[model samples]
Target: MKVICILCDEAFTPSKFQARKIMKHPHKIQICETCHDRITTKVNMQRTAKP
Candidate 1:
């Protein structure tokens, strides 16, 4: 499946670190290679539950 970053609010390939270490969760967490080591969704866990 294609992944959307849960940090920078943008589309990107997810990080292997967040994908595996964060359990089997496909949401709530995100990672991207082109995000400058940053997440792509630009979402805040304290507010949104999207990924």
Candidate 2:
């Protein structure tokens, strides 16, 4: 299937194995190269802040 990397902002075609790899990650991830970094960085920063 064709999935864009949400972090690198680069489109890609991931095989079944690759898709499985991404899905196995702990973080909440969605295939979208156009906005992966934005989502990850924003979420991480929010999560790391002192409550």
lDDT per model vs. reference: 0.55, 0.68
lDDT of 1 at 51: 47
Residue-wise C-alpha lDDT for candidate 2, range 1-51, written one tens digit per residue: 566565566678766776887678737555664375677899999999959
Model 2, residue 48: distance off in Å is 0.7
Local accuracy of candidate 1 as per-residue lDDT tens digits, 1-51:
456655567776446665575557644555456664333345454348754
TM-scores for all candidates: the values are 0.33, 0.36
Per-residue lDDT, model 2, residue 22, is 68
Cα lDDT for residue 5, candidate 1: 57
Instruction: Report clash pairs, candidate 2.
Output: 4-33, 5-33, 6-32, 6-36, 7-36, 7-37, 9-33
